[model samples]
Target: MSRTLQSGYHRPRMLRHVGRFSPVRIQSMHYQSGRHIRLLLQPGRSLYDALVRPLQAIGVTSASTTILGGHFDHLEYCVAPPDPSGKAVIAYSSPIDAGASFMVFGNATLGKDMEGRPLVHCHASVRVEDGSVKGGHIVPQASIIGATPISVLVTALEGFELRQAFDDETNIPLLKPFKES
Candidate 1:
């Protein structure tokens, strides 16, 4: 209680938002069976295609994945900063190109978009050619893998599905777990 009050006082600022308050913070669920897949993201292919196509062929439409360290011929990522128009908390900057970079690791959530197609939301840390390390949201489709193959551990969610629906709280289309309909 004392620590919380001190921290609040130190900040002396309350972040303002443009939306109404909501009761729920974290919406989560569990499954009795977790389907696992050892996916190999082939070299010389877009990260999106490498992950999506093979999984699709196996009839896996939704999952959570961890991308192991690998290389990419051309990588594009974005940094999140304060929103310019104050519409929301933050917005992604223009895609930043990291030429011939090496991906250290990554976490991605696969879901269906509003159009009912595949969508991958991924954030990764990378080691750039200049020896600098950075992490951010990855543009998977635009990122082409290098000659070395990358491995990914995928946990497919059975019974239910993941969908990117318009989240009124965030005022964004975020991936949310849902019951299969």
Candidate 2:
């Protein structure tokens, strides 16, 4: 819902999540400098494999990546909406297919899940073949790269790592930076 102001501007209502508020609103960590990498996403591979395999080869497990414009043979993404189960604040909707789309840009976070395996959380804007523009969380494993190599700029985090742990306030597993054990 939105309210029109006297000044002729409209403001949308802010939706509150059904969860206990946490004292720590933003969970973040920082280092002196971040290691950078110019990565190329290879064609004919899942975005997950294209990112994880190469970065792991160089021992980079935790980082943030920016995916510059690129093409995909197939792409699927999901939007987040209020959770009906009350288990978490929000939940990802079912994957929406965007066939043969061109990725306008994307920001991805590389981390380790509870199982200690590589996990990539990526959000992107895409242009579908039919000329519709949409943006949402990208499904890396389902999205296949196109013929040309896609460029990605990676900022590797050092001294600390991002790990998914159960967040009590939100009652969800979220990635937070923690000092290396």
lDDT scores of the candidates, listed in order: 0.90, 0.93
lDDT string for model 2 (1-181, tens) is: 4645577656676655556767887877899998999999999999999999999999999999999999999999999988888777689999999999999999999999999999999999999878899999999999999999999999999999999998877678889999996
User: On residues 1-181, what C-alpha lDDT tens digit does candidate 1 reach at each position?
Assistant: 1443433335455665657666888888778999999999998899999999999999999999999999999999999998898888778999998888999999999989999999999999999777799899999899998998899999999888999997776666889889996
Off by over 4 Å in 2: 1-19
Which of the numbered candidates is closest to the native, going by highest lDDT?
Answer: 2
User: TM-score for every candidate vs. truth?
Assistant: 0.91, 0.91
Worst ten-residue run, lDDT, model 2?
A: 9-18
Candidate 1 residues lying further than 4 Å off, grouped into runs, are: 1-14
lDDT of 2 at 73: 98
